[model samples]
Target: MLRRIVTFVIAVLILGALAWALWPRPLAVETVAIGKRDITVTVEEEGKARIREVYTVSSPIAGQTLRIDRHAGDAVAKGEAVVSIRPVAPGLLDARLRRAAEAAAASARAGVDLAAADVKQAEAQLTYLRTELSRAERLASQGTISESALDKARLAVDTGAANLDSTKASLSVRERELERAEAALIETAVSDSTCCTDLKSPVSGRILRVLAESEQVVQAGTPLLTIGNPADIEVAADILSHDVTEIRPGSAAVIGNWGGPPLAARVRRIEPSAITKTSALGIEEQRVPVILELASPPPQGLGDGFRVVVSITVWQGHDVLAVPVAALFRQGDAWSVYRNVNGVAKRQDVTLGRRNNDDAEVLSGLTEGDSVVLHPSDDIQDGTSIASTSGAQ
Candidate 1:
């Protein structure tokens, strides 16, 4: 009887050990509790800092500009002489340029002669048409010609007069062209210092850039240097057109990644126009310019065309329930999350509002203080046992 009892006890102990070994355990997961906080949705884009009013100095006449003595960041007062240009002397002018000028003058003179000939021809035609009209009127009164013939003659005279006026206008235009061409032949005095024309800054600012650093012959309107007030700066960002709709003029903005503390700014305007640009992936994107004025003075060393990142707030809320974006996953057609419920993983479908790079706003199906899995894996299912979590097995 004692041997039989021992065998039964040992068999029961073995059965219990096997059962314990085979029983399923909980899956370990990272979990986070839903929290309420202030949330803001923003659109970020690369931007540049630029001066509001930049003045470009250019050669007023075709001449040789002296080597630029000024460098970037050189301060210049308004009316200060920035550079000088020596007007090209008539004898020193390029042979081709002189020849071109002579050719242009000759062409203008020929055009004037042609226009005068046209005017004289029109006058002669008018005289002939008037004579014809008088004869037709007499013949019509004498019943030798129909009134239609007289009317035709009258129309011819009217048309001839109009042609004469048009020819006169053309002649006037040709005359003006000849005058302009002759004026171009007038020699500028090159015997004295007066020949060197000093160009002055039109605004009070520092030289922002020196476009032409060395002495060179430049045509009229060739840029020499750029001037602007460095302190008066603004930021320009090109945002996707579809995303710009949420950005309004006067919207609050933050300027970052500019090698200094983030600067506060306000959107001065959103350009009405949008430019089409190709993204790095070769996707066509419609980008619009957004100008933001610095709410405070920009930090030192920030200047024109310096790169920065801008974040424009489009939406904001107070005391909003939010969750980590990684916690949510696609379940059927809606978003779902594994909510930790009393040591069990419960599948809960959630409604999401605005989302950014890190977090998502929960609109429904979840409340504050609820625990949810951070990165729920495939092994986790509804009612699955979970461990290493606050509300887990």
Candidate 2:
């Protein structure tokens, strides 16, 4: 009888201990106090710094770049000569080509001069013909010449008149030839000027690139140097296509790593075209280029093509009521949070709005000064008992 009573009591104690072990208990959580603060949605991007206006200096004529005054990073002002070009020893057909070009040019000039002379000669002939015709008519009228003789005089007058007309026509043709010759002369002179021609900067800026080395032969239109104003700098950053819809002109930005401190900026323009850029994940992303104008000019040391870090502000709110994003929970399209009231957890459905960085805008259901659970778990249910510690409320 004694053993049976002892076994029964022991079995009851074990059953009670097992039940206690399996029972639910209060969950520990992190909490955040709701308040108002400024939040901004930023898109981080890496871009290369570039001058506002870059002018590529090219050879105006085919020649050798014989002189260069300044190299890259050299400061230059307007009308400053940066490079000089001199004609190289003429090409394979240099002599013959030169002679032909010179001949063509001379012929054109002569043609022009001849046209002017012909015009003068034609005017004189016309005047003389008019005088002779008048004399012939007067003689016929006075009967000093017979009818056939008068007729002969009239024919001579007609021949003179025809000659005058032919001279005038020749003058017109020669005038056109003169224009052609002048063009030919210019072309030949440009190709064979042994004297050096200076290439000057059109604007006050710094040299960004040097395409020509000393004593290098170059053809017309070959770029020699690039110069631009470094004071007026702009950042061109590419943003993902999906994120582009949220960006617009006049958006705020923070520019950094242009060899100096962070600078404020604003979006000036957004390129309408989209380009494909391969991401590290091997996904092809459609990106749109955006131009951000720096609010403050960089220091003098900054040069063109320098790398920069840009953060474009896509959305912003100031002095608005917000809550920590960790405190919010999403269910379908709705968001909710666990509000700690008198050491008990209560579920409050919240209407959430624009969020940025670490904070989110609370539209309703939660008021300022309310404490909400941060990163609440599924086990924290409605009307649940809770304990408040320094770390967890």
**lDDT values, one for every candidate:** 0.91, 0.81
Error of 2 at 164 (Å): 4.6
Q: What is the C-alpha lDDT profile of model 1 across 1-393, one tens digit per residue?
A: 999999999999999999999999888888888888778889999999999999999999988898999999899999999999988765544778778878889999999999999999999999999999999988999999998899999999999999999999999999999999877777666654655799999999899899999998899999999999999999999999999999999899999998889999999998999999999999999999999999988788798899999999999977889888888899899999998888799999999999887788899999889999988889998999988454321
lDDT of 1 at 89: 62
* lDDT (Cα, tens digit) per residue for candidate 2, span 203-297: 99888888776778898999999998889788888888888898889988988877777889889999999999999999998999988887877
Q: Compute the lDDT for candidate 2.
A: 0.81
Locate the minimum summed-lDDT window of 10 residues in model 2.
184-193
lDDT of 1: 0.91
Error of 2 at 205 (Å): 3.3
Residue 248 lDDT in model 2? 83
